[model samples]
Target: MTVKVFLATATVALGLMAVPAFAEEAPAPAVTPANAAAPPSAADLLFEQPQMRNAAPGSTITYDYLRRSGIAKGPFGAPLQDTVTLKVEKPTVAEKGGAGTPSADARDIAVTMFSGLNRVPAGPFEDMTGNPIVSLFFENHLRALAKVLEANPRYLKLAIRRGLRERAAVTPVKVKVGDREVDGWQVVTRPFAGDPMTERMRGLDDLTYTVVTSPAVPGEIVSMEAASRSKDGGELLQEKLNYDPKAG
Candidate 1:
């Protein structure tokens, strides 16, 4: 089965410099080097802190998603699961091009998908593969959290205007990961409203949903849930996170 994902990109205007207009004969005031403003710091420019500290290099995080369609129902529907391994490598120069100096917050993560315990490598996220879906979803969640942590008005505005579509608010929630319960925050996307979709699909309207992340670990997304309606309204996708110490 193939599923289509739509993402919206928004462009924001940072700030405009005021250019003084003077008479034709008049000369502008001299601008001294001392008057020039310094460049933004790394923390000011980019999110310098790790949102998912537990997902460090060489660490493994596994997630399982329950997908239900017309052919299947309940939790026993078509199996969708994946395990992501964080690569212990420095950020490539190419990735740092526009970002200028590199920061410790950059991450290189890879994911592999499984169907009922069988390995499957369909394609990348653009191909709408199961592996890509789980990986990209978490990636976006971290990016959104980073923006919120940075507290940069301009970037926050852009993030909201773009795909994230809403500022994350802290709502205390507890979830069962394995045997123990984990406390986290529930951040809902576009909480008040929903975005209109250009294309129609069964059991789906917009991509708006909610995600739970561990506050203790900052950026570790514990679970996600989104719903749509076909002939019947049900959960489109539900995912949970688990830490794998033995994964390599």
Candidate 2:
């Protein structure tokens, strides 16, 4: 099945106004894979931010579910009409709590979604009330890549450094979405001599197939979509998050 991935934008609004920044105040910390640990689970990735917990009491958050149908080009890329539910809630402070702090409450506002491939009983298997679990596999792979890049800067051995140095330098790849380009790293495994040589015999490069994309930016995709000579089919999977200012 061949699945061509694309995104359409949607906006949801909460009544809260954006606060102006003060010049002297320190800048908001950069959210990088190195600083931010891999989310423990899919649920932890979605609504576990301080901002979500700090929404004013009584404010409601809205979600829009999208189901799209398109031609798939992969082993399992059958015509898929998938429905994804986005649950949005604005966290509010319960008045009964003795803490007088304005936003001390730690309630979570999240959007949970399940894919057609998911067969778990829905409760203890994976939390469906929190983050969308559809994208967990991609997140884990990207983080693993980042760890490799940071630890080993020289990824592939250049001809110049072959015998002179015993180390292989790892190169970092730039990840971009919209106008923001994330700079970090991941470790990809290269194939060794004992690996399958059929592709190599045909003059095709033989490389071990594992890549980690670190800092797992939202909207970044790690799927392959290309034309092949063989008629063999495959499965296609894609998920996207489109954000915009709340509708007027």
TM per candidate comes to 0.45, 0.26
Q: Name the regions of candidate 2 deviating beyond 4 angstroms.
A: 1-111, 114-171, 187-248
**lDDT tens digits, residues 25-144, model 1?**
111111112221332222211122244334454554555443322223232234344454333333454454644544455434455555445454433321111112333544443343
Error (Å) of candidate 1 at residue 6 is 9.9
Scanning candidate 2 in windows of ten residues, the lowest lDDT window is: 1-10
What lDDT is obtained when candidate 2 is compared to the true structure?
0.25
Worst 10 residues of 1 by lDDT: 13-22
Model 2 scores a TM of: 0.26
Best by TM-score: 1
